[model samples]
Each structure stands twice: as structure tokens, then as C-alpha cells.
Target: MATTTISTTNIIQMTVNDNDYNSHFEGNLLDISADPEAYYRVVLFGYITPIFFLITLAANILIVLVLSRPTMRSPTNLVLLSMAVADLLTLIFPVPWYFYMYTLGYYKFLLYPALSCNLYHVMSEILPTFFHTASIWCTLLLACQRYVYICHPTLAKVWCTNQRVTRTILAIFLLASVHQLLRIMPTIMDDNSIIMNTNNESMINNEPQKACRQVIAKWTTSIENLYFGTYFVFRIVFVHIGPCFLLVIFNVLLYNALKRAEKTRNKLLNKQQSTEQRNGSSGWNKQQQQQQQSDDHQQQRKANRGRDANSTTVMLIVVVTVFLIVEIPLAVATAIHVTENMFTVDIVSDRFLSMTIIFSNFFIIISYPLNFAIYCGMSRAFRETFQQMFLKNLFTIRLTARSSSLNPFISTATTTSTTTNTTTTTTTLSSSNTATATTLTRMKNISSASSKGHY
Candidate 1:
């Protein structure tokens, strides 16, 4: 049996029949045919990337489907839809390309020239940046919209318009593309290629001249470092630090607003309850009791409204938190790799270290697709559309089960209440049911109003 061993110094090398073959690593791709150990690494990625690509592609497609529905096509949903599109691009272009390179022993379409390498790097960087930046900005917009809706309901209608949201998304994409283009130029242009031979000697005759162009300069180091440093600073701000700060502030403001609303609701409920108690006098108090009950019903409606607002805030926080947790470490790692002076093939060639970084890239790509599930779990509108679009049968099954369970209880209660209740009691029961129905109808109307805008 043949054996392969990987270590810090020889992670990119393999010994076969008393001879060693080393893998040559340049910018975005690796030459692994010479190394048995390196082949294992590529094989690992080859097996896994296809799975991630398909899964993520499916998830993002589902997101688009849910967002495309006329009822779900709010400004918020539109932003999410764009995010899904960007994420799909992120996965579709980059991961498949990576898998191709890994499985085939070289990058296919991207190895045309050193210039082509730059183009591919720019593309690879741009797609990730576009999707990630768009997601963060969209989430921020949604948070602000939510803040406006809860903190200033009347002004929310005027401020958070569909036009403004569309413009914001456009601006985010344009700005991200520009920034990514500028930041990446220095890294790509610093190509310095040095040819080496099969005997580990400088060989001019047998070498592919294009692959010889590598990026190495003492000056290139400073320029590249500056470029990566700038990128790192921006990434930390835009992706991690900025979003976290906004989330904290938004949650604080939302909590305060909800607290105030809850206090008002509770006070009103207490007042209505007191009024009912004071008016209590059997038949004489029945008229007064009905009026107080109406006020209590209004108070309950307000309380429910506040609860819904809180629920939305909580959901946004969860989604943002998940995104930040998954992507920030990868950002930090890339930052270190690009900016730090200590980065060399020697440090990077440690088998464990290389594997860790390689695994991080997988998650980074996979994270884009997972956002749909996050949105579904977090957003009520998304969940409803998703259920309607895909889980309709499951919903019907659950609805039937609920109906069956409730039928016997509802019938028994109706019979008991009819037998025991007098005219006044019947009137109160009627009013209670009317209030409940009114609340449900109002909710349905709001949902329908939003639904009408989707097409």
C-alpha cells in the first residue's frame, strides 16, 4: 500500500519511491499533481463543494420564490430578494469554479493569462463583497424601517417608501462594486513570477511561463499590505462592528418604545377593569359593563400590536447575529493573511492550518445560501409565503388536525353556554366573539393590503 504523510514543512510535498514532489501554490489556485498529500486536500473539497453548491443554490432559489409572490413583495421583501440573487451569484460562480479547479488539477477558464488571474480574483472578491455588503445594508434598511414603524408609526408610511428602498439597494451595490475594484487592484497587479525546474532548480525550458508570474516585491508587500489593511478596516466596520452597533442601538430604542407602549396598554386595561368593577350592580350595571368591555377590547388589541412589533425586532436580531457570527472570523482570517508581514508559504503550508483556512472558505460560501432559512425562521411574511409556496400540503394537514381537535371542544362549549346563558350573558358572549373576530379581520386586512402590492 502507498502511504502519504503531511507535516508543517512537507504539507505540500509527498514522498513516492524515495522521491519527493512538491505542490506549487500561486495566488488563487494550486498545482497539486506532484504531491499525494495535496491531492487528498483537493479531493476533500471536490467531494464537498458540489453538495454545498447544489444546496445553497436550492435555498436561494426558494428565497426568490417566496419573495417573488405578489403578497410578499414589500420593500423589505424586495431587498431580501436582491440579497438572495447576490448570494446565488456568490455561490454559483465561485464554488463551482473552485470545485472545477480542485477536481481537474488546474483552474479551467481562469488560467488564460496573469491578466485573467487578476480578472478572476476581482470577480471572486467582487461576488462575495457584493452579496455580503448587500445583505448587511439590506438588513440595516429593514432595521431602520422597523424602528420607524414602531417608534413613529405615522411618519413610517411617509419615510420608508418603496422608492427609497430601491434607491438604497442600488446605491449599496454600486458603492460595493467600486470599493472592491479599488481595494483589489494593488493585490492583483503585483504579479512576480519566478520559474523553477523538476529537479527543484530554475528551469527555463520546461516551465509554463504564464504560471511563473507570482506577486513578490518588498514594495509590493507594503502596497499589498496597505490594500488589505484598508479592506480589513472597511470589512470590520461594514460587516461586523457597524452592524453590531446598529443592532444594539435599534434594540435599545425598540425596547424603550415597547416598554412605553406596554405601560400605556396595561394602565388602560387596569382603568377599564376598574370601571367595570365600579359599575357592577347586576341588571342595572349591564349597560355600563358593555361600554367598559369595549374599551378593554381596544386595550387588548393595542397589546397584541406591541407584541408583534417586538417579535419582528427579535427575528431581525437573530438573523443578523447568525450572519455576523459565521462570516466575521473568515474576514479576520483573510485580513491577517493579506496584511500581516509574517504570511509565507512556510507558515501557510502547515497541514492543520491549511485545512482550517480551507474549511473556512466552505462556510463562507455556504453562509450565503443559509440566509433564506434564517429569513424564513425570522420573518413572518417570509414564513407565510414559504408555507404557501412549498409547505401548503403540510399546512393543510396541520390545519385539519387542529380543526379535528377543536371540533368536539367547541361544540360542547357552545351547547353548555346556550343552555346556561340568559339574554344579558348571551349579549356579552356575542360582543366578546365580535371583538375577537374584529381583531382577526383587521390582521387579515393588513396582510391583504401588503399582499396586493406583491405583483
Candidate 2:
């Protein structure tokens, strides 16, 4: 067996006997000889990416529709809307198109080398990276919104408005664009190349004194040495690892606050129950009944906060988890690739890492789209709104009557009665909006109390 390793110039080199020869290719078009596994690659990707496309497409569309409804348009919902858009960009453009191009490249359906280069560079690399980065930052923004809502409720009303959410989303994309542009520029932008020698002295002699003048974006030795060496590690840490830690920590703090609130509410409830038991059934008059109702409402509100925390945490954990699973392998693979290219190690000489990365990339494609499932499953509020958005008119009355039935834990009993003219949804969310705000306010105090205790 031959030893194959990525060379110092960032090109793969296979050691061969003197009688054997290394073929030299100048273009980015998939060479049938070098890539014997292209057929299986096509078949695997054909089945996988389309599944991603359909699921992601349907899920994000549902999310958009659900969030676009009147009562569902909260500040947190706006952040979610932004996330759906960012994910949709990837599904709409980069993902499906890659399928088309990959199929074409494998089967030689369209042999236009120039076009293939453009497709690979722009569609496969740059555009997807752009939206993927946007999707990541949108998640960070959601975490930030949650932080404000749970930890600083007084500021959430002021800071977590529609205009601010829009501006923040825009700023995120803008920064992501500039940052990713710099990262990907080494791939797309023109650069001088030091093309590798293939052990064919005559072919090397005949090779152009200047590297191939035209390109579908390509990374050259100069670009790698200039940009990638300095930025690759930093990019992975800053954009990938750091944000993952931030998200986990934010959710942890939010979860702790909810636990504290639940503890306090439980103690109060137990104390009230014991007092009522001592007072006995004969003492349960109209005034006592009213006070008990107040106590029940308090219990319901506490339960609501806990339910809200669980649902939100479930979605966040799943999304962040999928992201970590999808992205971490690719990041590690790329890091190993860069290290091998720089130092010429043969630690992973086979195609396993590349295949792992390709499959992992599919999940990343599907991650942004799966949030709809998370929302629908973990949240009664989301399911209710989703039904009203899509399954309206036909099932509105039946479903609306049964909306809070899915999870009584999430149902807000503190509703302010509305005129008969108002719709059920209007009354439900109106009260829900109040309850949510109040719960967050209590959580704010809980956070403050914890802070004071620690201090």
C-alpha cells in the first residue's frame, strides 16, 4: 500500500514506485480517474440532500406562516422568524443547487468546466457558508433575547421590540457577511498559485509558467499561507466553539432561574394548602373560595413559567445540539486537514474523514429546518398557532377549543375575560401575553435575588 498525505502546499500527494506516475490535472472539474468514488458519492448525496431540502423547506415554511400570524408576533418570535429566513436561504439556493451540480459532475451530464467551477465556488462554498454563518448568529441573538427576557425583564420591554429585533438581525447578517467574506475570499478571490509537481518532469516543463489564468474559485498556496494559516483556527474558535459555550451558559442560567422560581412557588403553595386544611371545609365560604382561586392562579402561573422554560429549553437544546453535532465534525476535520496540509501528516489518509464531513454537512443543512418539529412537539402554544395558521377554517373551532388541551401545564388560567365579539385566540394570547410578561418579571426578580445571594 502507498502512503498518501496532504503536502505542505495543501495538495494531496501519493507516494508511488519509480515505475508508477502521478497524473497532473490543471482544472477543478471532477476527474473521473482520480475520483473513483464519485458514483457512490452521487447516489448517497442524491438520497440525502433532497430529504434535507423537503424537510427543511416544509418546516421553515410552517415556521414562517406560524410566526407571521397576528398574536404570535412577539419579540422572541421575531428572532425565530429571522432564523427561519437564514436557514431557508441555504435550502433555497446552496443545498439543492449543489445536488444538481454534483450529479452533473459525477455523470458528466454537462461538461462545461467553466460553469462547474463557478457552481462549486459560489453555490457550494461561498453562499452556503454565508447563510450558515447568519443562521448561527441568529441563534445567538435568540439566546441574547432570552437572556434579556429572563434576566432583565425591565429592559426586555424596551430592548426587545420589533424594530430592535429587525435591526439586530440585519446587523448580524451584515457582520456575518463581512466576516465570512474575508474567510472565503481566499477561496474565491484571485491569487497566484504554486501548482504541485506530479513527478512527471516533461509535464511539469510543459505546464504554464503562470498557473491557470482562469478559475472557478480555488484556494492556492499563497491564499492558504496568507489567510488560512492565520485565520482558520481563530475562525473555528470565534464563530463555532465560543458561541456554543455562550448558548449553553445562557440557557443554564435561565434554567436555574426557573428552578428558583418553582422552589419559591412550591413552598408558598404548600404553606397555603396546610393553612386551608387547618381552617377545615366548613370555613371554606365565598371569601375563602375567592382566596383559594387566587392561590390556584398563582400556582398556575408558576407552573406556566416552568412549562415555558422547559419548552424553550427543549428547542434550544435540540437546535444547539444538532448544530454541535453537525458542525463539530466538520470543524475538526478541517482543522486536521489544515494541519496535515501544513505539516504533511498521513494520520487519516483514507476518505473516511471526507465522507464523515459530507454527511455531517447534510445534518447542518437539516438542523435549521428541524426547529419547526421541535416547536410543534415541545410547545402547545406553537402547535396552537401552527394549526390556526395552516389548518384554519376547516378545523379552527374544534382545534381552538382544544388548543390548551394538549398541555394544561402551558395553559394560562389567568385570562382576563373578553367581550363575546373577540375570538378565542385573541382572549387566549392576550392573557398569555400578560402571563408571560408577569412570569418573566418574576424570573427577573428571581435572577436578581440569586445575584444578591451570590454577592
Candidate number of the best lDDT: 2
lDDT of 1: 0.62
**True lDDT of residue 65, candidate 1:** 83
Per-residue alpha-carbon lDDT of candidate 2 for residues 1-455, written as tens digits (9 for 90 to 100):
11222122222223332322222312232222234455555765655677778888888888888888878878778888888888888767665555664644533322234445445557766777788788888887787787787678899899999889989998988987887677655443222233333432312543422221122233454354656666666666767666767777876776786677668768877987887787676677788889877977887797777668657755765666666667777777766776777677877864876776667776676566668878888777789887766678667677876876786754444333443436775666577867787887799999999999998
Report every candidate's CA lDDT.
0.62, 0.65
**Candidate 1 on 1-455: residue-level lDDT in tens?**
12332221221232232221212212322223333355554655566777777888899888888788888767767777777787677666566555656766563221445575555555655666666676667767767777888878799788777788788889988887777666555443323232323432222464433331223333345466566666777866776567757866776676687688779777877977776666674454666668767877886797777676677666665665666666556655554554443345343534554555566666766566667767777677778778877799787889989887879688788877877777666666577866777887799999999999996
- The lDDT of model 2 is 0.65
Q: In model 2, where is the ten-residue run with the lowest total lDDT?
A: 1-10
Backbone clashes, each candidate:
7, 0
Off by over 4 Å in 2: 1-33, 36-40, 104-116, 183-224, 281-292, 295-306, 342-347, 394-455
